[model samples]
Target: MSEAAKELNDIKRLMMLLLLKLGASPDEIALALQVDASLIRKTIPSRKVKKIVSEKG
Candidate 1:
């Protein structure tokens, strides 16, 4: 990938981690980070998704 794309991916990963830690939804974190929610969702792991969902449930 190009440098910019790599950077964007890295930022998305960080945003996903931060969102999980902060208990924020993907849409909320995407809006705060000014990126796409699909990107955040794609970067997050299934285990992480389960954890987040379990916490909210």
Candidate 2:
């Protein structure tokens, strides 16, 4: 993937992980991440979710 696309994907993944850890609803996370909730849900990993959330907090 192009560098810009890769960066965007990484940001999206991190946002999803953060949202999941924060216990933010999918819709809320999507809004915060400026993307669709389904996309975030699909991209984020369950294992890393908590880590991202905690780090953000």
Candidate 3:
């Protein structure tokens, strides 16, 4: 992929992480972003999810 596209994807992933930290579900994020939940779930690292969940819990 092009550098610009990669950067955009990285930005999107960061947004997904922030949304997740704020308690947004993957489905909600996907709907809002007009993308698939699987993509959102895939883009965010598993460790990040665990950390967010632990911090929120």
Best by TM-score: 3
Question: How would you order the candidates by TM-score, starting with the best?
Answer: 3, 2, 1
Pick by lDDT: 1 or 3, better one: 3
**Could you estimate the TM-score for every candidate?**
0.50, 0.52, 0.68
lDDT score, candidate 3: 0.78
Q: Per-residue lDDT of 1-57 in model 3, one digit per residue for the tens?
A: 999999998887888888888677889998998988888787875446644445443
For each candidate, the alpha-carbon lDDT, in order, equals 0.71, 0.67, 0.78
Candidate 1 global lDDT = 0.71
Q: Which number leads on lDDT?
A: 3
In Å, residue 50's CA in model 3 sits off its true spot by 5.2
Candidate 2 backbone clash number: 0
Candidate 2 least-lDDT 10 residues: 48-57
**Superposition error at 10 for model 2 (Å):** 0.4
Ranking by lDDT: 3, 1, 2
- The sequence of per-residue lDDT tens digits that candidate 2 reaches over residues 1-57 is 899999997886666666677777677877875888777666664545553344443
Who is ahead in TM-score, 1 or 2? Answer: 2
| Model 1: ten consecutive residues of lowest lDDT | 45-54
